[model samples]
Target: MLSRNRAAAARSMPGEGQRSSGRAAQRLLVALLGAAVGAAVAQADEPILPIPPAPALDARKLALGQALFHDKRLSNDNTLSCASCHDLSRGGVDGRSSSIGIGGAKGPINAPTVFNSSLNFRQFWDGRAASLEEQAAGPVHNPLEMGSNWAEVLGKLSRDAPLVEQFKAAYPDGLQSRNIQDAIATFERSLTTPNARIDRYLRGDKSALSPDELRGYQLFKAFGCVACHQGVNVGGNMFQTFGVMGDYFTRRGSVTAADLGRYNVTRNDADRYAFKVPSLRNVAVTAPYFHDGSARTLNEAVDVMFKYQLGRSAAAQDKELIVKFLHTLTGEYQGRSLQQADPLVARRP
Candidate 1:
């Protein structure tokens, strides 16, 4: 039954998901997958944005959260907010090699984009938090990150009459740090970017993308880049090592404390060097890439991924085309109004 399903899916799915239209694509995909892709091709039909959109944002709540996301007051020394690392205008990343935490502490890891982050299986590099609410509270409490103890942060929030009143209204249980985190997390959940050229193409608009973008998409699949980087988020649902068929960490040298990666969370040797794959949406805008932000240019990041993750190299032409296609992945936040209009956002001081 599975074989028949796969065979049928393969014959029908072409170019995004069609038959007559994607003969070339189907042929290429079949060649790349070597039969396995045929069976699971149907699975690819699923949209990547499974994350339920945040409930209609309460303006005061999201405004409050947005303020907090950019609020330096949440830091011990009033130096950093979520925006310090995850700047939305810059593709939701700050474009730094490593994020500067409280008191100018340089973190060992790159600041992952906050845009569309809610789609991940788990939050953070280590997959520690299970939900956005928990994840939002993480940085503030991280000694090196925000450096603000939740209790102290709560105390400060309590002092802000406007913030307190909004919080009170949002949560009948009354304002607390956890509630604040949930509100902010909800706001973050609304921070989704959609409608890239690829999206238009996926939705059956062939003219939405240029021919170069289409070729890049072909190269992306032909070279098997989508094996792990598939789905609506375009790569957040799975975890893989930096080097599957290569030695990425070894190439970099001795594993630093921060480079322990998933081992720190999983405490398993097999998990060493493993990290959750990041989303490619807005990747062109989010430069200074990777877990540690070692790659400064998107081209360099693509080169590194070719060498390490996919275990293959791209021809110069193919590389250029893929990079060009990658630019199309950048899109506008689909839920910005929710965040900006949330009562919580409006209510924040």
Candidate 2:
């Protein structure tokens, strides 16, 4: 009876057209399965995560903060603004190896990018400033930076009727130092860049990343580079010694007080040469790299990382591929590509 029923069902089945359609569907299913497995493998090896878009902020406060950010009144000399070191038009950095402050005084360490700094667990290379608000206050009062006290700054701001009015609209206390810090910090938080090709790939767009970029990402993880550089900000959530496998400072020669890194803040020997891991977002544009800015190009930076941090050597091709992946991390700022805003240094051979 089973055989008879099977024969009847076969007889009722569609002709060659339906059979061909079924075969095609099966092939498609197999192809999809293969792609899914590939993607899963890629994900398992991916360590760095994509940055999310900036959250909605109060427009009034953001506007006020932007004005204050560009206003030179914050500096004692009236020649330097917050924008002097952190140039919004140049990848949120001044493009100097070490930033120049008031009266042409150079800072001890390299200035990290201001973009997406709020994502960092702690501010500054030494992690001295706990939050963006605290970080904002550092340069303003530092003898080398803006070189002005709150009294001087507020006195200048108070003279400007428009700025004072804007401050009143943004803060209940108006032009106080705390309110200024709050406003600048809020503006910094809004500086996040999202929607990079790598981010799109992370969001499940299979075609977003090229074959080289995907390979580079896998290699980046396999090489243990991800251990220190994981999470949304890539490398900002924790602190790591600059020279894990080698004496980087000694080799570089010229170890300054800034090179003491987190040791300066903690005063612990264990924290020697330890610095807060900087975010890799928009890194391609924000060079020269590292706390000292020793590496002038991305290729050179990758080499330095492998030698000092990873203690592992990679082939030149592999290094190039890794650099390619890094390039994909440059995202859009205000609906435009960020790389276009800054002129990158020429690549070294």
Evaluate candidate 1 by giving its C-alpha RMSD to the native, one decimal: 13.2
| Tens-digit lDDT string for candidate 2 (66-125) | 888898888999989989888877788877788888898888878899988988999999
Which segments of model 1 are wrong by more than 4 Å? 1-55, 334-349
Clashing pairs in 2: none
Q: Residue 276 in candidate 2 has what lDDT?
A: 97
Error of 2 at 310 (Å): 1.0
TM-score each candidate: 0.80, 0.86
TM-score of 1: 0.80
lDDT of 1 by residue, 1-349 (tens): 9999999998775555455557777887879776456434533563433233345777767776777787777888888888888877666777677777987787878888898897778888877788898888888988888888877887777878987887777788777877778778877877887666677666556797799998998888888888888787889888888888898888988678778778898799998888888888777777667787777666787889899888876688998898888777766665332122111111111
Q: Any runs in candidate 2 off by more than 4 Å, and if so which? A: 1-46, 340-349
Error at 197, model 2, angstroms: 1.0
